[model samples]
Target chain A: MKKALRTIIFVTTDADAVAAFNAYFNPNEVQISHFTSGMGAIQYVKQIGEADLLILEEHIKPLGAVQTIHYLKDNMNYSGGILFFSDSDKNEIYTDNEAFEVLKKGFEKSDLDRVLGLLSNKKKPVELNSKPYSLSYLINLSEGDDIFIKESIKIFNESVGKRILEIEELFEKEHYKEVSNLAHNIKPSFEMLENNLGSKICDELAHSQVDSSKLEQIKLLRDEYMNVQECLKQDFPELFKRV
Target chain B: MQRILIIEDNPMVVRSLEFKLKKDGYDIVVAEEGRQAMKLLHEEIFDLILTDLMLPFVTGTQIIEHIKKNYPKIPVIVLSTSTQEDIITDAFKMGVDDFITKPFSPSELSLRVKRTLSKL
Candidate 1:
């Protein structure tokens, strides 16, 4: 027997949105509940247990998307994925995390289908040869400008390399606290690129715990940085001069 | 055209916001850190302020405090990734007009800016 679609809690004040959702997803296929207010939705979830997915409308009056997500995450400790939908041009604020996605009012059923498919799959699809260069950061930052992409890559190539050297010098001087803070700051950039090795090294260096072998963590971070640099040089040969 | 100041450290965010706001015909000035923002606030008059909560040299709260004390006439909006309730509550108490979180859509930001300006 095939498994049933996950339960989805669709929270919204808009009548049209509710109608759209009802028309799209069959009730029998997936468990669905509709709440008109953020507080109401929260209460429903609290009464039962967690919903597999939360489809939140950005403009839910007194509770809104930000406050609702805040309460759910901070107070309730709800860990399910969230899909934010907005009918207007109001900016929806959210972090770039594994369980978060956004959809606009005009999105069709296919868009919702694609997002739902991704959310249902436990394992994320891997990109081919992601190790050579983590391009997602630039892809987002540049937004498809060829010149802008090239310039950003060049700047990252120069600035990140310099910062790595600075971190090494700081480590050599035994300024561990400074190293920790610096690593903490740089870790987000690596994480955005999906470079797990670089992010892991940074996390190890940033930890407040002190050990005799902590310098080894810095050395590992340095090696990871070199690998990234080499990868960039090899992939974008025109951007870097032969050393 | 309305003149606005953007105080943010992230270069990507700055570029995106500046592009959209400028296209909407707002005159803009940018500062990459809290101290630079302070300097700009003193040197020029602005209709509104958009700032990130986490900044170097000075924190966003400190900047908001300074604005409330001296530039109380200007409306302020916060754009940050901080999820702390105390931080946000404190900003509202200090008289910030609005709050937005990071990774927000540009269209949404533009609309908020327009609405806030219209209210002012």
Candidate 2:
């Protein structure tokens, strides 16, 4: 009989971290899901009934890592391994029995491997079939509901093109703040779709100063996103039939 | 059913709040701006109001003022990212019942909302 794959949920607001995490685990046997907000992660945990292992980034927006930990423990009674990754030297610590483990962000893969080893004794390499511009991330988000995946992709295809244009125009107008807000607003959509380049570019644009150089990057990202969507439609015509 | 008026501009936050509150059996009404909230307030009565301080057209403070004048008995909860000590203190003085910061836990926010409504 085939062994069941372990499910891992990671919550972080950082787009780059999501890309790295997704790429690192692409060839593994474990099932991984990403949430951009702590609250979303909490809701997923509550709905799903339990968590096997949860990795949380401290700087996650709308709810930081500490609060997420408190909620998981107090509200959901989540007693799983929670790997807390952060950059600051707060020097704070949680007792082991609380099931909270702290690790510094930006560590190498081996560092994470060691941490994973500490968390579970039966860590197996689970394989996930991932392709560039694949809908695997959206599939995970929708829990394999093809209809939801279809709608999400359709919406993304329709909106992102206009959003990219607006972002570029706003940057050209020297409306740095508006550019940042728009970029911040759309970054999650890209992250959810596993469009790493779009997510990464948006993150930078959100923090970027008002400069002409920014438009070039935005233009390049737009072309890439347009190409990815075209490829997606071509690759899965039936899935994106209405799109 | 207890009705809640959520005054928030962010669609993601609004959806999260609406989903969680709806799941808990509350009738949820959403207004994307302060003006829209005021319009809703004029047309309908809500048991409670949850608002973010920074809003368009009118402000959360202005909304509070309107509520105090027209519907003095209704409870209000302020949810925002503002760390200005005076803003929070002023809200309390202006009859705001509870204050929760951004990125709040959904369950915790629900508990606070429940506690605040229990008085009514």
Candidate 3:
């Protein structure tokens, strides 16, 4: 029988940290839940009952990391392996507890791999086919309400579809800041649609400096958005029909 | 009916939020930009405010500061895609009542809105 993938709950408010973890972990091997605050992590734990591990930043707030760890262990009876991310010199503060391991800030992939290996046995990797875009997330968000799904699609078509054109014009005018802002604004729409390629392109565009490379990214995002839009129209003909 | 002023420029997000919150039966008013939100804030009273951190004409932080100083009783909830700790911490320190990340679950949205309003 195949074993279940390990669940890792990562608590941090750093976008870079979240991006790093997302890039490192194989989805088939580990399922990760990210939360911005320790309280958010606690709420998730309360909902799911337990996870295999909890990785948190030393500076997590609302409830600090130490207090969060205590609440999870004592009040929630959580027995998961806990990992703390702190400055290399500050490892001594957490080293006192033998149960917890400290990861230095900006730890590399090998460091993460070593820590995971210590916590659990490695499972054989499996291959799976995944789509570039999926409405499963949107369907779930709508709770199977087709009307809401159709409306959201229409809104995406009208809003994001229009904004991309404006972004192109803004880039031409050298309004790099506006171009970046526009990318930041439409990013969530791509995420909501589960268009990872488009979302990733938007993330890059959101931070890119004024250069020819930024235009290349915008073109890529446009192509991806167009592809997703085409797919959505075909998948939901009724939704796309003239109203 | 409890009133919620939603300050967001994204039509897709606005539609989703409006759909769910209306189904939950709150009187919803939307402001596409921070300036419009400020005008509405001065003209009519709201029980709660659901605002995006990024907006045109005025920023969410500036709007929150205005609300904290002028309309201290109205509870504000921030909607953001930013995962930056300093921004989130600053919003809380500026008197934001709650924070909801984007691409949020509808069930969670319902629950958070209910929870925030119940505190009134």
| DockQ leader | 3
| TM-score of chain B for predicted candidate 2 | 0.95
- For candidate 1, write residues A1-243 as lDDT tens digits: 112356567777565665666566654355445665576557655544466678788777778877788888889998776788776554444553433457778778887686567555734322233463454333333233356556656755665577678888877787777676566556545554446777777777766564446877777877887888787787779999756
Best by TM-score: 3
Off by over 4 Å in 1: A1-129, A140-142, A191-214, B10-26, B79-93, B97-118
Clashing pairs in 1: none
Q: Rank by lDDT, highest first.
A: 3, 2, 1
Residue B106 displacement (Å), model 2? 5.1
Per residue, candidate 3 scores C-alpha lDDT tens digits across B1-120 of 999999999888898888878877999999999999999999998999999988998999999999999999999999987544578789999989998988776656876888898998
User: What is each predicted model's overall lDDT from 0 to 1?
Assistant: 0.69, 0.69, 0.77
User: What proportion of true contacts does candidate 3 retain?
Assistant: 0.66
For A133-238, candidate 3 gives per-residue lDDT tens digits of 6454454444346567678888888889899999999989988889888988999899887777787788777766655567788889899888988877777778
Cα deviation of B105, candidate 1, in Å: 5.2
Cα lDDT tens digits, model 2, A104-171, are 66768986676556545745433332433545444334334445556666667766767778877877
How does model 3 score on DockQ? 0.29
Model 3, stretches more than 4 Å misplaced?
A1-130, A208-210
Per-prediction DockQ scores? 0.09, 0.05, 0.29
